[model samples]
Target: MNRKDQSLAALVAVIWGFNFVVIDWGMGDVPPLLFLAARFLAVIVPAVFLLDPPPVPWRTVAAVGVFMSLGQFGFLYVAMDAGMPPGLAGLVLQAQVGLTILLATVVLRERPTGPQMVGVALGAAGLVVVGFGRGGHVPLIALVLCLMGALMWAIGNVISRASGATGGLALTVWSALVVPIPLILLSMILDGPGALADGVAAFGWKAAVSTLYTAGLASLVGYGIFNGLLSRNTSASVVPWIMLVPPVAIGSAWLLLNEVPSTGELVGGAILVFGVLVASRTNRIRREPARQAANSVGEPNLSDPTPCTPDLPLPGTPAQPAPAVP
Candidate 1:
């Protein structure tokens, strides 16, 4: 990535990092699923009217929504609501890089390079360390939920990669169409009508601002700039930049929310993120030949497709994960 693109990627990391705090702040008294439903509903409007869904089947879009938007954020919001600190949440979610790769190996039949395998192993070890240490700081259930959220995000990543949809706002907004209704209905069941009513009544400026950031700035603007970068660069260059997000999230949370990570978490997160950074280094021998072959025939470089999703572009981004939800 060039300096300008580097700046933009860093900006995305900052936006997404602080987003965990924003999401937590906004859900003050609201149920997690309801808050999530509102955010996704906000994500799709006006923009959805402005463009058509990505040129993919409705089922494909729907599946992406279920896993990416609904499942990922569903578990994420609930986990945060359950007591997962924003900084740790960001760090733990980096597990998506390894999850996406393993999933792709099984589902997409995409073989990972040796470095990627080593990186995934290291990431798994880091998760184990975090798991053993999390009981003191974060709720055990919350940690598990957050990991589930990462797993869902990875599945969505694989689905999008398989579809080969050039990601953009259309895909984000359209796939998001499947998010709100399910969440809202589930929120009703879980939170109850009285609590739901109270949540709606409590919706205020803080929640609105958070929603705007998550839906508008983080989801739309962040994903758009990220897609533009991926279009211009390889996943090897782009995914590593996103690895900075955990530190940004941790720093922002410490400064803003007074949420400090434990020593164990810090060490484990460092290991996990380092593994992801290492994994981001691509196998040029495998990719360059394919890219050259495609270019020689006037074909698009299939190795790097602009993944259009609110949470992830891990198709090739996996093959290390980047561009997933905040």
Candidate 2:
């Protein structure tokens, strides 16, 4: 990633990191799936009509919404309800980093270099340190659910990367249309109609403000930028930037919520940053865009209005466009 994009990714991570504090603070007695439904509902209104859908097939948009937004958060909210600590929830969620890299290797066949592998390993170590440092008795089901969330999120990452669609706003909003109803139905079923009704009855200004921030900034703007980054960078190169999130979350909690970071967390935060730097290599290897048209991460400047075409051919591979949106 270039300096400009790296900076943008950092900013988005900070917004997302702080988002946890806001969500926990404002959630009150609202059901998690209902809260998520509200956020996505907010994401769609105005924006959906204002901007056109991404220039991809309807199925592509739906796939992203299913795995990335609905599947990821559905498992997470359920896991948290099953008694996962919010701090540990944040930590466990990032398991997607390793998952994304591994999936990219298997599916996309985008191999990471040795240094990149080491960087990813260091980042994973940082997460482990952070997880251990923030000790909690994790329930087995919640742990499994969280891992499922991570896997869904990783699949979403690869889907977005494969789509090669760089217009983050369009993809984020249009795909979001696939979210609210199913989640609302699930919220009603799992959380019960009474719980959902009660949660809505109790919704207040705190929840509203939280919803605005989460829906407006975190969901729409944040993911818009994130989707673009995925299309513009390799999954390995882009995903590790998320390691910064836990540290930022901890630091923000310290500053605003009076939750001081432990010594281990501090060390782990440093390691995460170093790991991202190592993995996202400062010197980007740029590839000249084919037909001077918009394509993969190598030529970050171009835009593909027609959704995706192909990844740059791997060395010695046939000059055929790679598979996409499967």
Candidate 3:
């Protein structure tokens, strides 16, 4: 990636990192499901009318929408509202990466690399530590919900991969259309009409600004730039930059929300992050033979040829995987 694109990718990371704080600010008196519905409504409107639907089958779109958009954010919003701090939410949500790997192993029958196994173990251990550290600061149910959200994200990642769609933005925009009604209905049913109405009446500038940042900047702009870079560069180059997100989330939470990580959270989060990094490291040695074979035949040898695994978007954003083309 060129410096310009790299900078753009970094910017996206920052936007996504700070997104947890934005969501917290936006919640105010709004019901979690209702707020999520509004956010997705913002994402789909105007843009959906202008953009063509994604080329993938409607079933794929619907599946991705349900799991990625509704399931992921539904659980996350509820978790946060239930008292999971934004900083820890940001870090814990990344367990989706490891979860995806495990799911792929079971469903797709892919063998895990040693590093990946170790990473998954380390990440799980970290979560256990985080769980033990919860005490009264964080709710166990909230942490469980966040982990469930990560699992939903992993399911969505699998769906996106199976769809074989290259147009991340199109998929994202179109899939968003599936979210609002169900969420609103759920809000009405679960939160009750009275609560929903009161929350909407109480919605203020903070809610509006938070929705704009989440729907406009984080979902649309962030995914736009990140997917654009994926089209022009290797996923290996682009994906690692996502590791920057947690630090930014941690720092932003401390500064903006005045939230501090407990010692357990800090230690566990570090172990988890390090485990994910170890797990994600590609086996260059194993790929050298393939590279040599391609070179001998005069075919172009990509420095990083692994299939791009899409990262789960922050709450309110759809997951956008890069094209599998080498």
Ranking by lDDT: 2, 1, 3
TM-score of each candidate structure, all chains considered together: 0.76, 0.86, 0.74
TM-score of 1: 0.76
Provide backbone clash counts, one per model.
6, 1, 0
* Preferred candidate (TM-score higher): 2 or 3: 2
Task: Give per-residue lDDT, candidate 2, residue 50.
Answer: 94
Compared with the true structure, what per-residue lDDT tens digits does model 1 show for residues 1-326? 55687789778878888888889888899889999988988898889999866877899889878997899899999999999988778878767766766676566455667676666677667756654554557788998999999899778767766666665567778888888888988988988989889999989999999999899988787766665564455333444455556767776877888866677757766876776556655542133344344435533456868754334445667523222211
Output the lDDT of residue 203, model 1: 90
Overlapping backbone residue pairs in candidate 3 total 0
Winner by lDDT between candidate 3 and candidate 2: 2
Could you tell me how far off, in angstroms, the CA of residue 69 lies in candidate 1 after the best superposition?
A: 0.2
219, model 1: CA deviation in Å?
Answer: 1.6
Against the true structure, candidate 3 has what lDDT? 0.73
Off by over 4 Å in 2: 282-326
lDDT string for model 3 (21-93, tens) is 8998888999999998889998998899888887879998888788878899999999999998787787678
Worst 10 residues of 1 by lDDT: 317-326
For all candidates in order, the CA lDDT equals 0.74, 0.83, 0.73
